[model samples]
Target: MIEAPLGDPIHHLLTPEALRHPAAAWEPFRHREGLWWSEVLDSWVATSLADCSAVLADADRFCSDWRKLGNDVPDSRLTVQILDSPEHTAVRAQLVRAFRALDWDGVRDRVAENVERRLAAVADRAAFDFMAEFAVPLALDTIVDVLGVHPPEDHRFPVVSAQIVDSMDYALRPETVGPGRAARAALAELTGQWLDGRTSGGLVGHLAAHHDSGRVTTAVLRNSLRVVLHSGYESASRLLGNALLACLDSPGSLDALSGGVDDTALQELVRYAGPVQAEARGCVADTEVNGHPVRRGQVVTVLLAAANRDDRVFDDPHSLRLDRTPNPHIGFGRGPHACLGAPLALLLTRTALGALAGLPRPLRLLDQPRFRRNATLRGLERLDLGWG
Candidate 1:
């Protein structure tokens, strides 16, 4: 058996500072061959592309439920993210079909309108935090509207979503857990109310009918809606912020996108600067990953960002290539647990970028940005930008 490496556990690896400079944070361990125990995380860290893919694909040997990862939460089997095998397969089929059937053009139109409105509001200001004043609101409103719920004109829904997303972080304080759980429960109740016998056209109504037909459990229906709401906005908002920053950093990329890049190019942008840095899975059975042993009930974190930048995969992993084809990055994850809202996220992203394409050259940063401190979610809290 290969022994786990010994050293100071990587602390604050997900801090804004660390995430902003991933190479500095991960360079030391990039040379490590396989899975090694991280004392800081009390979980094994998988850095290489091969190792991360192995952990994500072999679901029989690993679990995705949070309860398995030491969280004292309610039963999670009904949740789309945590469900395994047969159940996950069935539920995901329904969700996938429903999501694909969504009027993506309509969604894009709505999101584009929202984006224009957000920009109009900030057009008068000298500069504003792009994250708070723009990305967050646009994401929250667009997703909520598509899900058949009225987006509150204030910060209520955004606040709730942020709380739930933050709770997913590995390092949770005692104080944080209580609020997170409460927010989750509240969200469930809110989602159920929105879907209760509503005939209005939307994904939630279809799910409600599915629930009423006895095809799906109440828990499954409610939690699936919860998953969409949580996953849709949190990741999309951060991705918008990251992608915008990336475009500003590379004017040629902005020019290429402005001139109309295809879905493949949009995907390349996600691969290059997507917000998700890492993902966690719990090992269920003894298995060897990339020739390294991972025992039952052990947590393994796949460094997705690292894998995206792996030299063996992309021709120039660090360079932003708009036309990179066959780019099989795990930005949305892989296997059965791949992001369910990926299509919607991509649509929204395309619309957002298209809107940004109209901005004047030489976007300016009004102030230094601030990033959230959550270990799992990498996003900016504030990014002040302007173009005059």
Candidate 2:
């Protein structure tokens, strides 16, 4: 029944202010009408659970093309995330096989080891930037380990990867375009180097194996690496930061999880404070959703954060409850476009959070939290934390 003030929808929706305080911006449009047309971007914003699910399911009506949104990154080859329909299905089949072969339990053990090392170094400090000290490295190392990319000791993988991820921030201003271009160029160079013989037993190696066997082209191998590095680290890093913040805020929930939380509890944590908050989709044909008529070429922004907190679906939606049952949150998305690295992400989060919970000094959030200026991937930029 609440409504956003009558104004430029895009400005209100995509600005840094809105992202930092999403609940305020979201309140105006939550349950009234599932979708609203953004005049600035000329897109329809879907702000409810049911509507988002409907749009995601009807991929025939809603297409997933970043190019249509003016992101002309070229089509030398397609990554699994960018592809749709039959092509997507084929590529996923090959990827799933390789993905299945990965030793995730082994991966979790490595993550626990890394987190312990990182935490031990900072245990003595009264306060530290969790983003830099913990979250960033946790995400970066896990990704590097998974992809099996190797480089000289002097090589800055995290720096390059951060550039690629930050450039994709939908909230990036026109002035930031220069940096974005530079980041893309850097990633391209890195991809080229990796393609030119820098391979270990990682995802890149798996793709390289396919490339050598003539199953996939050089372009496909390169683009897939680029996509994985960008998408994989961005969301997971944010989730790490967010999950830590969630624990600091909800001691009860954290205690419940730490004691002996099951998969369902972890799912609720992801639902309550997941990294990815929204997803972008474009309409392929005329369609009707929740009484609103959408035409072809129209953009629809699905608010996953809003959906997670939908009162219609979640009881006491604003509160964080680890034991909340029947929680069908779309944090990782749904259907064909769902996140491929979800299992890895879960392992990383569970391991990292579990390790932090076991720390001797109780973790506490420091003053002045900073949020990243990204509407699509929601997370803190600088989460200061302290322990005894």
The 0-to-1 C-alpha lDDT of every candidate, in the order given, reads: 0.75, 0.71
Top lDDT: which candidate number?
A: 1
TM-score to native of every candidate shown: 0.91, 0.89
Best TM-score among the predictions, by candidate number: 1
Tens digits of per-residue lDDT, candidate 2, 310-382, equal 8899998777787789999998998788888888778778888877776666777778678876656777878
Model 1 lDDT per residue over 302-336, tens place: 88877887777777777788888889888888888
- Ten consecutive residues with minimal summed lDDT in candidate 1? 1-10
Q: Name every residue pair that clashes in candidate 2.
A: none
After superposition on all CA atoms, what RMSD does each candidate show versus the true structure?
2.6, 3.1
Native-structure RMSD, model 2:
3.1
lDDT for model 2, please: 0.71
